[model samples]
Target: MADPIPETADTALVPTLLGDVIPRVESAYVLGLPSPQILDLVLERSRSTTVLVATDEEASQLKDELPDAVELVTAGIAAFAQDRRSQPRELVLALGGLDGLLPPADTMPWQQRLAHVTALAQAGGTVIVGLGNDAPLMALGHAERIDWARADDDPTRPTSAAALAQALAAAGQPVTTVHGLYGDPVNPGAAVIDALATGSRDGSLPAQVVEHVIDQAGTASIPAPDVVAVAARSGQLSNLATQWVAVSGGRGRSVYWTVDDAVVWADQDGPGLDWVIGGDADTAAALPQRVPDTITVERTLLRHIARADLPAFRAVARQLGDWVRSSADAAESSEIRLDEVRVAGATLARGISLRHAPVTDAAPVAEDAPDVEREPDPSARQVSASEARLAQAWRRFATRFAHSGRRSAWPAIFGEEDLVQLWLTMSGVAPGTVAPEADAPAVAVPAVVDEASRLDILQDRVAALTDTLAARDEQLLIREARIRTLRQQALGAARNRDRAVKLAQDLRRSRTYRLANQMRRASLVAQPKTLVRGVARKLDGKVRALRRTR
Candidate 1:
């Protein structure tokens, strides 16, 4: 195990990126071992009082160390995020033992958890982490790294301070002057507090450090690949790419891909790549080839910059300028003639000025070379009849109007079909309407011919009428004969009816008929009397039987 720093307030306060960033820190993520000194300084300096500890061990330790007024919770950052009992408060988290806390391969989950912690800290919270040496630096996101080296002296602090200063300067936040942290017997745990106190003692320690680093970084010519790697490690790749796009005169648009074992960079959604560099070689060898040597420094240098990528931009820009000069000299020594150039398959040439004659008569064109005809894009192609009509109308309207602007305005005046018909009418052409036929013309004829034709027609009509009259007369005669038969049948039926009535009257007046009616009436009256007498006799018999029984 490594020896710990001696228990003394006298710690050599080294000027570092984190130290420079500490005073301006409304929030922070100090990635190193849990420092009681640092925690005490943060709690004293920061406005937030709530300290959330991820592990039970940290929580137990904090409960004993922190003041009773400061609330300490053992809940993970995610749990605090879900709790809505009150408004979110700025938090102080003690994250330690990263190597044992999370497995190395579990990057995605680790990133997600870290992002959750970041979200929790969004409300003015600060996270102090104890990062292992093998910790994936990229997964930490854009947080200031504070190295917790036990050794009283560390060189990396100056280097980091320089980088931070240069980055900030490149982003247009220049430092005029700064103070260096090189005092013996300085408090490393209370680094921020010491910085502020030191600055107060000599007008501003951060300012002095920023100026010193900026001066160092501005003059130094570091390798471009080293700068890129540093930015990537610092989680500023996206910012770097954005700056690159902006520098290339692209509207913050770029795509990354591999071509011929080299990274091909191009405009967003463009037809082809603009710059190619990077293959099996490392970043240093590949970076110089990103742009052609002919491109000017002004054209390739980024104008728009993000604060996070400021350090990276400064490092890369300074190095690229030096590389460009060195590479240009090398390229001059081994220049190839146009005739010696080998164009790849499907290579496109545009406005290329040929310094020499045709390169060996343009080697025989391949028979398989496709005669490509571009199909119009769906969005660009005219697909609708309405659009076609609108286009046609626009052309016609342009022909008529003095101002071209009237074409768009004319549509509001007339509906579609109406507009077309109006144009047709205005052109002195009939608008697709069928006119009624005019009355026939009156013409005179020769009397003799007219008379002969009329007489022939009249004769034919008379003959047809005569035939029709004869047929009608025949039908009338048949009807008359039927009517005569029907009248005779009616008369015969009436005679039979009169005879039948007379016979019936004679029968009613006859004596036999009268006697039969009187006899029927007498039988009906006697039957009822007989029924009553039988019923009385039966009742009297029943009465005599009942008296005998008694």
Candidate 2:
């Protein structure tokens, strides 16, 4: 709410994530302190609204930001609930959840808070609650030491999605759908329903697609893709999600993913999943009309690697090569990355049709200017030409695979370059044609390793990279010294040249030199024949002198 953070591409994620589920109501009530952008979204969706914040400071801040039509309430949950006990709003949004809404000074029970929120919403009105998972998978990797002396302020707070959903249902507002939120809590990159996560199979398209979405939305510290892979295999992804959004009295889309700032959502109501993009109108318009294939070749390959299925991996690689050779043009082939290629039956399809054409802000063109066909920008063409060559793409994949901390089908001795060559050969590409750029020394990654060994591998890689950087730095220093010496020499030569020119100008400007030049000119004009004879005699004398010397 502090001057409303600048709207980014992902700014509309929360609103759009909840938009379909939120009923089109005339009035709404927002309890607790949600983001200003979210409030603005809520305001846009509803005609009239009321916002309640715990502190006077928050109320004062939001008062200037919210419109005049919106009624602002500043009080704790108990006070707000007592004041508005009789007035139940049509829609209630408590995205901040119970943590922020219940102040430490207030002794209100957790169940009572939930009851207050549900009571604030009229019967059949939507109540959306965004709750944090206290026992998320991240806790396993990054567990904080408990302070036994500290008081458990909110002991009854729901620890998991199920408990939160159960608590909400027990409060008379039965949850219709529970969405697992991933990435940033305030601005989640993905929102998937519990049903989809629970129903998806390990190698199915839905499972692959969900994993892909989770992969993109992973946290920095945890290897989310690997964690998700393990979790999905064990059928515990829903239970281990970072956060959950419990929706009561409304049904929402099954899956939501934020890609390039656009929101892609799909409902599991049809035979085939239909991904719909929702965001900037221009961006949505520019995207391919047809829905993208659910599963990506990268995801498929990753799954194969996870399961140590060498034959399947090789077959997919060959399929990808065939697709590149037969289906794609030269320009398109250069941009075909594994992640952007989709598995279409036995063949492969381009996952995103407009990878090269990024959505950009359209500047107004001059009306008077002629609509002439212009050549593509050479820089862009050069980039496209250099991007995603067969060897290069495979090399990138190999490097990722090496550092992925997942089990691989290849031998322990197989480094990134070895994997690259092997993959290229498997893909039916002539590895002999690959002129691989001189790369830093490869770190031999172990095929399988524990967390400690993985850390050791990472350290070894870092050490190798550091050595490479040091060598490059030494070369750079030598080049810099040579450049400095050349620059000094050039400057000295310029100064000498300036001095020589100055001296020449001084001689030319001297009175004696000027008088001599004028006298010579006058003599040549007055006695042209005499001057010519004298010049010939001088030349003859000079020739005799040169002949005598020789």
Candidate number achieving the greatest lDDT relative to the actual structure: 2
Off by over 4 Å in 2: 1-10, 145-155, 200-220, 270-295, 302-309, 328-334, 352-388, 405-408, 411-414, 440-550
lDDT of each residue in 171-197, candidate 2, tens digit only = 998899888876554456667787677
Residue 479 alpha-carbon offset, candidate 2, angstroms = 74
Q: lDDT for each of the candidates? A: 0.34, 0.68
In model 1, what are the clashing residue pairs, if there are any?
A: 11-186, 32-130, 167-310, 167-311, 178-207, 178-208, 178-209, 179-208, 179-209
Q: Which stretches of candidate 1 lie over 4 Å from their true place?
A: 1-33, 84-86, 90-108, 123-550
Error of 1 at 74 (Å): 1.3
- TM-score of candidate 1 on Cα atoms, chains taken together: 0.22
Strongest candidate by TM-score: 2
Q: lDDT of candidate 1 vs native?
A: 0.34
